[model samples]
Target chain A: MRFGVVRFPGSNCEQDIVIACRYLGIDVDYVWHGDTDITGFDAIVLPGGFSYGDYIRTGAVARFSPVMGEVVRFAERGGPVLGVCNGFQILTEAHMLPGAMLRNRGLKFICETVPLRLERTVCQWVDLPEGTVVRIPINHNEGNFTADAETLARLDANGQVVLSYCEPDGTRAPGGSAPNGSANDIAGICNERGNVFGLMPHPERVVDPEASGTDGQPFLTTIVARLAGV
Target chain B: MARYEIFVTYKQGIFDPPGATAERALANLGYDEIESVKIGKYIRVEVADGPNERARVAEMCDKLLANPVIEEYRIVDAEGAVSAR
Candidate 1:
């Protein structure tokens, strides 16, 4: 399968995502933020980075990129779209999801490998059993997800929440688990249709066992299996 | 000319660590009298019309300036200066 990794002006993780895609045996290419056409790819991944220098807000300015229009069209056509970190911020800004990430309450740039519990794994890129715990790296200061009560309820009822930080033993990891103060401890979410996924964790940075942390391999492998029908 | 004020703040469910920390600091500073401290953003705009313009400005807050999910904005229109809600 062909996978396209979007490279915004300040995207720092595109190469990492590209490497992960290639390791999965998928044809990978770079899709510039200025390029509006999202053709020639079965899936697209918006890697993490400080796009637009995070001027107004993290991912706020990047949401207005020329390629975002096509990315929206791509999602509507049922193409897979995954946004990480600032990419998640952009998706929220674009209204592809119903929320926003604000500055971290601690007012510090946090970076570390965080444990994430698999909330719902039936989506296209993931197939693990529900409630599984996986470690993924998260590095961002504005990863707090906030939404209205009704909207949070809707997301909960629809099972749109996909992943959350959890303890290794499977119990809900509180406080420390949430590097940022997101509502409901939400680390990741998928669109109502389940085609578009957004998360604050950097799975690409942990694709291989020796690369950084092997904990993130299953996520990429899940998508690989979906592509290979394995 | 008429004036309008816009207020923005975190939604209910979000954890306001800074606010909590500020409250803690205040308590440590012998200001235990305060209950909570919530950070907020305010914007003021000048327009010609009254209520109609206020509504338009509110819509702008929803569509562009403020994120409705984590933010609630109140607009007040006045003859010269408006106050934020």
Candidate 2:
């Protein structure tokens, strides 16, 4: 499957996503922020970075980019869209996902590998069994996720909470699992329709075993496998 | 043209890490009497004067200037009149 990785001004992780896709043998190309056509791609990825210099707020300015119009349109038609880190922020800003990211609870930019437990939901981005733990790197200053209590409840009830920070042995850590103090230890979520997914962790950075671990390989390969009906 | 200043801050329930950290730092430096500290953003905009300019600014706040989901913003007129939502 062909993946389109968007590159907004100040976006730094687009190349990393491209490299990961290349390693996965998936056809990929860069979609400039100014361009609007994304019809040729099977799925789209909004990679991590300080888009538009994170002006006003993270992802606020980037959401208005010309390319996002098409991305929104594509997502409406039930097309798969994955947003990583800042991309996740952009998705939330674009209203494709719920909630907003706050600054890390420690008032510091955190960069480290953390364990994530996948929720058992039939989403296009993940097909892992329930409660599978995978180690992924999270790097950001504003990764603390917050939402109203009502919205949080709705997400929980609908199975929209797709991933949560967890212990290495796959146990949930109360109060301390989330390095950034995300609400409910949520590391990732999906739209109610499940076509759109957003997460704070960097799955692409861990796709190569030589440089990093291969725990992230399944994230990309799952899409390819589903598309190819393998 | 009218100049306006906007102050955007996290809502009451949302966590303000920088603000909390600053509060701690101040206490560490022997200012233990401080109750709280909050961090926020200040923005200035110059807009053409019109009958509906105030309404327009409010719209701007809702649409882009501030995220209503987690932040509250106040608009200050040049004369220091504050309007909050």
Candidate 3:
């Protein structure tokens, strides 16, 4: 299957995602944020970055980019989409997913490989046993996930919440280890439809320990397996 | 001319970090009377006079200007831009 990695004007993780897909034996290409056509790919990856300088808000500007038009269309058609870090912000801004992102509670940039607990397995991209922990790198200033009480309740009831922050020692992290202070330690979530997934952690950066860490292989391999009909 | 006012505020459950920071500042000044604070975004737009102008601007605000998931916005005024206020 062909994997398309979107490239916004300030996207910094496009190459990293592409490399991860390549390692999985899937051909990858760069889809410019200005392009509105996504006909040649089976799945799309919105990589992390400070698009539009994170002005006004993290994903506010990038959500209006020319390419997002296609992304929205792709999502409506049930095409698989994965958003990481700032990509998560863009997805929320585009209304492809529920909730919005705000500045980190500590009000500072955080960069580190953090542990996350798998919470939902209904998503096609998720194949891990529930409670499995993965260490993924997350670097951002605006990564807090927020939603109204009703919406949050709906998401929980629908099993849209995919992951939660965990301590390096494999236990729940109260506050500091959670990084952005997201409610309920949420680290990732998917839309009710389950075709789109968005999370603040950078799985691509963790595919190789030498490059960052090797905690991202499971996610990548899971996607590859799905596309390969395994 | 047609006019519209949009009131966007943080969704009820999501913590407003910026708003919290502001609240902390208020408390630091010994202003103990304040109960809580929530920051929000507001936009006022004026358009050509038309029957549907108000609805149109509200739609734009919902689809583009404000995100419904984490914020709620209402069109408070739509009467022709009356006496700049």
User: Individual DockQ of the candidates?
Assistant: 0.41, 0.85, 0.53
Order by TM-score, highest first: 2, 3, 1
Please give, for residues A80-119, the per-residue lDDT of candidate 2 as tens digits: 9999999999999999999999988887899999999998
- True-vs-predicted CA distance for residue A210, candidate 2, Å: 2.2
**Candidate No. with top TM-score:** 2
How far out, in Å, is residue A180 in model 3?
A: 1.0
Indicate whether candidate 1 or candidate 3 has the larger DockQ.
Answer: 3
List candidate 2 stretches off by more than 4 Å.
none
**Tens digit of lDDT per residue, candidate 1, span A83-129?**
98888888998888778887876778889887888886435767778
Relative to the unseen true structure, what is the C-alpha lDDT of residue A117 in candidate 2, on a scale of 0 to 100?
96
Chain B alone, model 1: TM-score? 0.78
Q: In candidate 3 chain B, what residue range of length 10 has the lowest lDDT sum?
A: B76-85
DockQ, cand. 2? 0.85
Q: Top model by lDDT, which number?
A: 2
Docking quality category of candidate 3 according to DockQ thresholds: medium
TM accuracy, model 3 = 0.86
